[model samples]
Target: MIDQVRALFAKNTFLPCDVSTIADDADLYDAGLSSFGSVQLMLAIEETFDIELPETLLTRRTFASLENIAEALSGLVSKAA
Candidate 1:
């Protein structure tokens, strides 16, 4: 799941640094994730995982880091199952 998230983040988010080099808990916003980029990433993630993230989960905190994104997707994916 993390791998998928990382791939989506790397492809969707226009980060200054390599997503692979960053730690799971690293701040993506600090790495150059703008609001527009966040929305793009969110849409890409939803399509890739076939899960629509609730509006409530669409926040800076939810997309803060790789771990956070994974955590959010984990819950949503489980519920989807």
Candidate 2:
């Protein structure tokens, strides 16, 4: 999931830095992830992970970092399980 997220960031021109080097806990927003880019990422994540994100998780806190993204995904995946 992290790999997919990194790839999404790498492919997005909005991300100002290398995706691979981003720390798992690093804030993507602070690293230059624009608000619109985050929405794009959310869509990518849904497609990649095969999970629909609930509206409750579509907030800054959930997308703040790679770790947060993973946590949000884990919740959704576990719920589906």
Winner by TM-score: 1
Model 1 misses residue 80 by how many Å? 1.2
Which stretches of model 2 miss by more than 4 angstroms? 11-14
lDDT of candidate 1?
0.86
Q: Residue 3: error of model 1 in Å?
A: 1.8
| Candidate 1 lDDT for residue 78 | 88
Alpha-carbon lDDT, every model: 0.86, 0.82
lDDT score at residue 52, model 1, on the 0-100 scale: 89
TM-scores of the candidates in the order shown: 0.90, 0.82
Candidate 1: tens digits of C-alpha lDDT, residues 12-56: 546767899989999999988889888888888888889889989
**Between which residue pairs do clashes occur in model 2?**
none
Candidate 1 residue pairs in backbone clash: none
Error of 1 at 23 (Å): 0.3
